[model samples]
Target: MRKIPVKYGIEILVICLTPFLFMISESISNGKVTGILFSFGYLILVGFVIFGIRYWIENEELVIQNLLFWKTRIRISEVSKIEKTWNALSSPAPSITGRVEIYYNKKSIVISPKNFEEFKNELLRINPNIIIKE
Candidate 1:
């Protein structure tokens, strides 16, 4: 199993802290209980943010795991295209630093794997017909 490294882990940490900090101010102005509840929820979100995303080849499919609750599975045979993108829109990608856009069955998803070249090569090994737009 290949673990896709997270390059923007620090950025994610700051993003997750924003809410908690906001809640601290809200607590000072509102109530203690509300602050406590928000803190707990924020911690849970932090856990998810820290874990980020992981991708690996499983069986004959590509598995993208987001946090602990969500996952995306794409069959190697169904992949149609792969391209580099600057799009920062949300998908299965964990970071916006560098992203790979994948097209399959008229649908698309963006992912940011640390070792992009290796990841692309792995996919190409499975499906050579995939049009890769460098």
Candidate 2:
């Protein structure tokens, strides 16, 4: 198994969870909610910090797990292209910076791994036919 370190999208996480936070806080202040809202928010936000996120390659598949709630797997052989991107529209990538987009068989996914070169080189090592653009 090859474990690739993740680059956090803290700003993106904040942006995504801010609304829930505000709602929960307001509800608490107004005594409108019990521990249920707090528990739900804790599951979503604290779960990320506690359970953590990960990316790796195993059995010729790339695996991505985020916030303890999801997992995505992609076959390395199906990957066709890789390039750095900063596209802001929405992506699985945690950060807006140093994002790499992988275009596979009729599909694409974005990931931001901390060690960019290592991640790219590892994929290339497995599938040399993959085209990479700087």
Per-candidate clash tally: 0, 1
- Tell me the spans in candidate 2 whose CA falls farther than 4 Å from its real position: 35-52, 66-70
User: Per-residue lDDT for 2-110 in model 2, tens only?
Assistant: 8998887678767657766777777777877665477476657654653366899999999988656688899999999999998775555777788989998898888
Error of 1 at 94 (Å): 1.6
Candidate closest to the true structure, highest TM-score: 1
| Per-model TM against the reference | 0.81, 0.77
Candidate 2 to native Cα RMSD, angstroms? 3.1
lDDT of 1 by residue, 40-119 (tens): 78888777755657778887688888778688989978999989898877666666667888899898888877887888
- Pairs that clash in candidate 1: none
Which run of 10 residues does model 1 get worst, by summed lDDT? 1-10
Candidates in order have lDDT scores of 0.77, 0.80
